[model samples]
Target: MAVGFAVLLTVGCGQGPQAQFSVRDTTEELLSPAQKAVKKALDDGFGTPHELVAWQRLPVNYGGVHGAVGEVLADGKGITAKWEGDAAGVTAGAPLLWISGARAAESTSVDSVGSFDAKTKTLTWSGAAEPAPAAGDKLVIGFGQTLKTGRMVYMKNCMHCHGVAGDGAGPTAKYLNPLPRDYRSGVFKFTSTLTPEKPTRDDLTRVVKYGIPGTYMPSFLWLGGKETESVVEYVRWLSMRGEFEKRLDDDLSGDFSQKAIEESAEKALAEFKAAKADEKPEKPRSAGDLKKEAVAKFTNETDGYEKTEFPGVIDDTANFLAQGWTHGEDPESLILPSVPRVPDDAASRERGRRMYLSDKGKCYTCHGIQGRGDGAATEDFWKKPGSDEVYERRGLHDAWGHPLMPRNLTLGQYRGGRRPLDVFRRIYAGIKGTPMPGFGRTALKDEEIWDVVNFVMSLQYQSAPAPAKPAEHVAESK
Candidate 1:
């Protein structure tokens, strides 16, 4: 009977750990109260990884013209807005949404709006706006400052691995082999775009829809176009948030700490309580009054500290964050080879093979001599960034501390793309967030890189070598 009960209990528990325990969510718990308040304000006004909030509407001004709603329309995957005044400064791929109230708090209700469609001047939404926006409601448009439809999609699909803050330190992050990407640096690897620039929206969308081949990031091919777009927007949003936090930390870390804020709050609460106790019986303070007084004190203390130390940090950080993303979308930042790709003939392949083996190229250091991805470097353990410790296992590792393997070119599987330009970009710009280094313009000229690109492309179609036979024994002729 005892054995049967134990068996039943084990069966009921299942093969894996039961999902009945509670884990504390430490996402924002480490933040100071003042920082938490700022994050809360951003959450309330511009949504978070967990919820969708309305965009904080701004009054429009175009050239001499000011405060115009402009004609806005929605489409399947994008939105378009046209106005009489100068819309020249309005950036492409910016976030835009309409809200009814004059202020963020008052603009509690909002439509499920998607991102702007710069090409067609249309605004797209997953569904039709409810109780359609009224005339008085203002249309807000900008980058890095709005709540978007993508926030919801990202929270559902990516928050577990990427974190609510997009720091790639989500609850499941510690368990993964390769750490998820931390977008705070606003840098992405495996882009077809140029160096020092963020990936294009299309590039990001492609990565989300089609997961990296050798990595744990699963493809979300099932998500329709609109849903994928939303996730992209949310990712950009989180990246901006992380950048802002980094900037703030740089400017304020010396002056502030969470302990200080907690102490301030505690002191304020105690003072409020004492003041309330001193009040006459007929003029007692309400619970609301004490709470309000405490909050005001906390805010004032923090505000004073900020003003005295970093007066321009807020505006500077916002502008810097916005510009960082905007510059990536600029046309001039793209890298196009000065010369066309060399023909994929045997000569070009041989030239590429030579470069791959040369010390200047150093391709064999990580990728084996035969392009088998079995290089000697894989035997050594790698160190994690910002830490004194090295990883436990031996292998190549990306910037995120995940074990990485040099691509086995013989497999002909390309994670980025198979196009000529795609291969060219990989050789030129190098894969970001990984050990790959860009060799274009600086180390190798455009033509040399193209030769390498041609060789890499040919690896897929080439036939694999047959296995070598072992030496036969004489077998004593029995």
Candidate 2:
């Protein structure tokens, strides 16, 4: 047995991570004590696509809103917070919905000391403790030469729900069933695999690329190619400031400074008269300082290695298919009428077809009269009674002013994932934004979902993997 100390300097660790324990993979036998500790952590949650986290642990800091209180579970599964302390007022200003980011996104709440607004969206902010001057507070609004393209992307598509200032508090917030992300508090929910905190850049990029399904969020992949990357950049910048401001606020107010200052003030009439003129004056933001900070952020991020070329369609499909193995939704050993095995003969396929068309399952309504998404109800689709109309609330427009339609699943682009289990999860969980309901206990049995699952999988929903050329023929042909 061979073992050596594994040392790793992590972002959270004071020094570079140095695993004191040794590890023992098939290649490694005896390990130093140091490697053992590192191995233990990995044994906890390490192997997933979420690289930074190996185990579930409580967050050191979780509040996203300045002075907002939050709690994390010991199990490391969830965290919740109250936007406002006033219970009754919370109801009055109830946000439609809240996008849950991970611990990293929450960190954004700490740094935001200022805000920016465009048109009707008025983003506001509370500066971080020991904060520096901010550009959004001065130059863009006052100097008035900020790029319309960069600002417009965010203001038009994101600001209404995320809050103009990125503090997660826009006026339309109440109307949204799920309040938009207060990127200021950098927490994010969707991640590729098991990650510890706010998703890494790729995680965020993917989310923006593939919006949450069955929810108010729709796929923005088309809008996310290179030209739209600027929008993502703006969002990332907003989230950074929000998290920083939030963290600073918590640190400063941790000692009861707000209360102490209020109690220490003199209330005497004569004193008040004398102090009126001496009241603290408003501190104006300095343009030079903010410009320097923004420049610094841009430079550092740009310094990283750049990806050279587009992998094209075949590579893209392969990458996702490989990822699908682990990312597919949880599967169960379901027992129902749905076919589970790959049919070997026409007889089995016939039975499967019968099950799909059978009155017991009648899976053809919304799916379409003939498996196409263009069912008779397509033109007549209406928002269910209890559901809110997300598109209506947006009330914004693109350069051309046409409305977007809901996804026609029969199209086969399956953004959630193309894996069998992923499709199964969709079949069982239903979608969010529409009238789809979970089949877990309702109409379909596990076996029946499998039956439809097989039927759906049989549909020509995805393109075939590109073929590889034969090595022997390639040289001769050339």
Candidate 3:
């Protein structure tokens, strides 16, 4: 059975905390005026955990009926409108969302819903708002309630660790060895999709239903199918929102960064000086005048981008997200094996072992030579991706910058699932957001990958101890 809303609301508090979604930590100083506007649009469209707007722009399945106001009642309490999609879901007690006109994007519960009049093809609802919806106003009834329901489930179950914004920095997050995922990055460590694509619904559903074996993420097998589906949609929605914010920042930063501003100001000053040098006036333009001119130019350029170009950028980003998400569900994005698994036998395991130790596999670089996860590379300094900056500590780190130790295969716990196909998929696509490179068609054949899978699967049963350290390393340690 699904957990009740009232019970979940106050799970960890004497008095339940008001439902609200936290914003990302990008400071305002870093954002230009245009970037801030994009952020505001996101906030309005997505709304709080309680007051969700099924931002028609996103690909999320908000699962509710929609329509537009046909006529406002004379008494200012209700409206008649033509309904579309899932008309049955628009029953009494379902919330009505006003998406246009004066009360745009606001939602209120319905006191009652009048029966559909087939002749007029319209229905009536009362108790929506003090000021009723205006004619031709777009509205949704029973819409995005799934999001609200999913938010309740997430708050009760996942928020303590994942946080309100899915930043993975919830109150208990710091203490966990492997921190909970930050969905804002729109990256998942394990997925069936190709390395470049996002996880499909089935992939996420599997994780939620059957939690990672070695990690603190526990299974929620008891949650019914509908509950699971709603939560998955919610998670996907959160990921999309996060990805959208990041894209906006990346696009705006090139022009709006403090360094960019300074450069623009300096360039303006240089041009002014150059032009004034030609003028040869008795007294050249004063330093104050030059500074003012530079400031004015900088302001004008920024204002221009904000007013003219930023909206298009925002729209393009949304369209990109929608297309990408929609494409993720396509079968082409999934990784399917060309051949069946090589028979799990002594020869196959040995062949797999060879691949593990070979430079081609390079598995030993991180997962120790004997599958113990104590590889020498963990002690070496590594540079962060996309930057020359070196990490302060020596160890492997995931995309999130959290220190990560490669799997100790001997432990027999596979976070991505232990099935042979699961292991094969891991090798084919590589683990997303990790150093685990996929040994797909380019690196290894389908049969060869299967052999490696067999070898990995056999590690748990081996009773042999890990090989001893080398003599030089032992002496250095001493």
Residue runs of model 3 more than 4 Å from their true location after superposition: 1-16, 65-88, 93-112, 116-141, 259-303, 465-478
Distance from true position, residue 401, model 1, in Å?
Answer: 3.1
Question: In candidate 2, what are the lDDT values of residues 316-405, reduced to their tens digit?
Answer: 332332233223222322212244544434454344445545544444444543455543334553442445543342222111122223
**Candidate 2 vs. true structure, TM-score:** 0.30
Error of 3 at 144 (Å): 1.0
lDDT by candidate, in order shown: 0.59, 0.38, 0.74
The CA root-mean-square deviation of candidate 1, after full C-alpha superposition on the true structure, stands at 16.8
- Model 3: how far is 110 from its true place, Å? 11
Question: Who wins the TM-score comparison?
Answer: 3
- Model 2, residue 259: distance off in Å is 35
Model 2 segments more than 4 A misplaced: 1-352, 355-362, 381-410, 461-478
Residue 387 deviation, candidate 2, in Å?
9.9
Q: Give the poorly placed runs of model 1, Cα more than 4 Å off.
A: 1-148, 169-179, 254-304, 381-393, 461-478
Better structure of 1 and 3 per TM-score = 3
Error of 1 at 123 (Å): 18
